[model samples]
Target: MADSNDSQPGAPVPCAACRGTGQVISNLGGSPSQVPCPWCEGSGTQIPGHDAQAARRAAAA
Candidate 1:
């Protein structure tokens, strides 16, 4: 297994939920479907500890 925190400090990190693919697989009844990640919105980059809401709040402040 590789380290999750491989990016440099202050750099935007790849999304963990999608592994930077910007998409995720949902298994239902053994069938897998691809859907855009709620985080990163298909761009596949995220702030270290920031979610969408928090990012928005920070931007607003």
Candidate 2:
């Protein structure tokens, strides 16, 4: 069966920072090395067409 996420006709692209893994390395000098990326909110993806800047502006508005 097709994956539900893949089945979406217009699913957002995988997040560049997290590369769709939904987590990034935290350089805060503590344990719990991985943290959810603020960009994709752990979803690990941005809107299909909008770049990161656009997405941020959109969110601000």
Residue 42 of candidate 1: its Cα lDDT? Answer: 74
Question: What is the per-residue lDDT of model 2 for residues 18-51, given as tens digits with 9 covering 90 to 100?
Answer: 8988888877766658877767878888645445
lDDT of 1 by residue, 1-61 (tens): 8787686677877898899998978685699999776577777886455576765466569
Give the Cα-based TM-score of candidate 1 against the true structure: 0.52
TM-score for each predicted model, relative to the true structure? 0.52, 0.53
Question: lDDT of model 1 at residue 9?
Answer: 77
Residues forming the 10-long window of minimal summed lDDT in candidate 2: 47-56
What candidate 1 gets wrong by more than 4 Å, as runs, is 1-9, 28-30, 47-61
- Give me the runs in candidate 2 sitting further than 4 Å from their true place: 1-10, 30-32, 47-61
